[model samples]
Target: MTFNLNIYETMALVSLILYLGKFLRSKSSFLTKYCIPPSVVGGFVFALFMLAIEMTGVATINLDITLQSIFMTTFFTSIGFTASLKILKQGGFKVVIFLGLAALLVALQNTVGVSLASVFSLNPLLGLCTGSIPMVGGHGTAGSFGPMLEEIGVVGATTVSIASATFGLIMGSIIGGLVARLLIHGKKLTTVHDESSKMPPTQVGDYNEENHNILSLKCLINAACLLFIAMGIGSIVSDFIQLTGLTFPSYIGAMIVAAVMRNLYDFTNKAFVEKEIETLGSLSLSFFLTMALMSLKLWQLFDLALPLLVMLMAQVILVGLFTYIIVFSVMGKNYEAAVFASATCGFGMGATPNAIANMDELTNRYGFVPTPYFVVPLVGCLFIDFVNSFIITLFINFIS
Candidate 1:
């Protein structure tokens, strides 16, 4: 029987089954639960598995790059949908200041990545990919761009993306709490507006006043049609934009189209588009991140050396200060708003989900959000990433 076991496939099955088991067991809390963010554990454990198997000359890892692309695209669509242009409107100068500082910090972060790679005698581009590019930005950005960098000759981009995401997840939760508590003590503002509640549904067009069946085929049809239309229109417009000799990330173009379509739907009072999009997006992100991580080739990193680790440390320190002192202090309105802004800053510069997760943990534990949860999710999932893509391209070109 040819003893075939694709290492990544095996690891994915193992990780998912393990995760499901823990879920079924009703385990709780990030601190105690064996859930150290499924991606991190999945990727890490899988790498170890591959190392063991490969060393014995038993198996090799094969990543399905095409599937990775699809999942990554869908995930980015979700990220784009979550952006809230409204809050950014109200935020005005604060948003400007925050974006500017964040842009500079990310540039510094890139520089730090290059420097670290040089120190470790590894490719500097690889350092950038794993350091802050994707991991901190979450699965959407990291996985979406990993293969692209790989095409550009940056090896081990996937692993670095996973590692960065793990670090971002950890830092996001901690920084959120610490900032919230500090703001309270410093008397920077009054009243925390975090209402620890479920993330509300996206605003649909008209609430059908006539209470109808929840499982109606029409509802499902409407939801599916909306997504289809959004996807279709988004694709056409994005292509047109690219055809015009301008460069934009694939997701950004899709999101602008989606957002525009959504706003237009709102005007026509038929705005039920993107309903349950999050479910689809989340599922895609989970699998995408999983596949991206499952093909861990640890042996490749044996030559990475120590200089790279120091560069990462420097970048982390820089981001921390940039977030705390500049972004938080200057963020807008009351203390609660500032905290949210601080967290948002992290998301724009780090990971959007991490941003919402941080805010979610904060509100869940504390209790007051002046800005609204939907706002953050909207911005994180949609608008910020679009903006970040543009910003990144600009930064790259400028540096080059």
Candidate 2:
């Protein structure tokens, strides 16, 4: 009844509740099926409950902003860790092609955003930001960078970015799946082979079980400390940018610095706990996404529902068309590569896990991965973000 309990208290409560629920099998069939990431679902659902309480004059929206920031920071720190250069090396030129296709989609996404904004007589510059990057880029990307857009006079920019990212996630999921299906139907799919053509196999059962690897508490702590350091460095770069009369999103620099640190550790073979890295990262993303979605101000969405729906529809159509026509053709119509490429754009232009899940759901049904699992995440989480930022910036400037 009392809402004054701090985050640690809240986290303990949440963990206990979840554990109890799991013990009771209290989760919904839909939830279990989607395996909805708790972060996104939990955060979102909790936020809405807060909103509902506010509407009923029972509570205020003091969203423990500090706690929110920490959760977001952890989520992105995981992102930076997962962005290791080692992934690209493992993935090889498949990584290169994924980046290339993502580059093009970033350009196309802005074109869609700006052009659509122009039709509605809104500021085209703001339109570009609210499109896929911030919207699809998730809360860290949106929250960190959204304020800058507001400072530059983009009204309701935060809301717009959140909405767009949510829409992007949905679109990415659908398009990624659709693209994979089409690819499999059109041609024989191939596994992505590295130069090592003789890639070593992990011990048997290391497949999805890789997601369950345990690591030392010390390593987790070390990784957390490194992420905090990255956040500090991100603040420095962000501050410098603000002073220089140039702008970028808030979390971008932090992610970049953290990514650089992650890569350095990986390259130097400086030991860091990375065994369960991918799984933790994926789980973090899923939860973050679920939380973000559950918190949706359903009312805010009600009025703009028409516009939001239009934007959502247009985004879906555009992403699909591009996936089928442009991406497939450019990637030499290699089914696996096309599937991966479309997913990169789908998520970059859309949602992270949506992109990955899109690929996975299709692969599972077909009984084969059209592309390497590592390929989509490598580009979506790490490489494509930088390119999308550059491309989105270009759109904003071009319209201005």
Candidate 3:
């Protein structure tokens, strides 16, 4: 029998999984110590269950994750909203340094991926699918480029890309926290939140909302207005740009729009409550992640298991070495660098949300550094996708 779930049912299931993950994490030492997000815990467990059922030749289940894109887009829109020019100015040289390094890492990921594919006598394009396409690009990019590879005669491109993205998501989450922990303890690094820090107190979903009635309502409406405007105007911007024959990701226009709005707000001294926007973005991210994990068609991954494993293992090692050696050293070798090192794992391997979650977990344990949070999201959300696409296209052409 085939079982299907509509969007609302799927969301409800996702919420249940989140709650279960939270409960289980509360009971488990390993989960607590590692700082695994509740969504990862629950969504991943449910995916494994579905995988088992498929392996057992039981009923096939499919989910209508239509809402996934909406949530993901909105989550990203929130990141765009957070891109305040004043904060970027404060981030200064370090932010630019990190962005350059991260762009280089995307190229290296494709290099490593293509090299592995060549060594294994697999289709060279298979490595591209497994590389930054899935790793740095996350599920959305995977979904986009996977079929393209398949159309060009790479068998099972979609399956491989999706599987690689899933692997990266889990690994990124696990590794980011561990790396941060090591840096914090080994380097004797700690942070104390300063009111005068360069970071605004607008962490996604975190704020002092003691006055949750009138203020929250007003702020939510304002944030909603701003986000919707960005989304609408951003689409027009994207369309206009595409007409000029220079293509970009769909989210770029919206993000650009939001950033412009944010800076304008800063310039005008408007009371744009960033905390509410952050909260809304956080909620969207949680929903997006849960839907993404639960919707993984693990059965599709069975055929390419061996080769994909080799590729994934190589990618994992590369990200680890890069984070510890280059990312840490170049970002200043301080407490913040260590945090960025951990967050970079997420940036390199998974989506921005994963990177943010990693930072959130570390900050929840240690104190907030704030700088890395601002740096990672801006790079991960705004710039990485732009650079990654170009490099991936270059590699694909070179390899093919």
Instruction: Compare the candidates by lDDT and give the number of the best one.
Output: 3
| Candidate 3 wrongly placed segments (more than 4 Å) | 118-129, 133-215, 241-248, 328-347, 350-400
TM-scores for candidates 1 onward, in order: 0.73, 0.77, 0.72
Q: Report the Cα lDDT for candidate 3.
A: 0.76
TM-score of 3: 0.72
Error of 1 at 42 (Å): 3.6
31-69 per-residue lDDT for model 1 (tens digits): 222124455455566667778888888765454345665
RMSD of each: 6.2, 5.7, 6.0
Q: What CA RMSD would candidate 1 show?
A: 6.2
The residue ranges of model 1 lying beyond 4 angstroms of the native Cα positions read: 1-40, 61-65, 81-108, 115-122, 130-132, 179-217, 225-253, 332-334, 341-353, 356-369, 372-375, 396-400
How many clashes does each candidate structure show, in the order listed? 20, 23, 0
User: Which scores greater on TM-score, model 1 or model 3?
Assistant: 1
TM-score of 1: 0.73
- Residue-level lDDT of model 2, residues 300-323, one tens digit each, is 445555655676567667777877
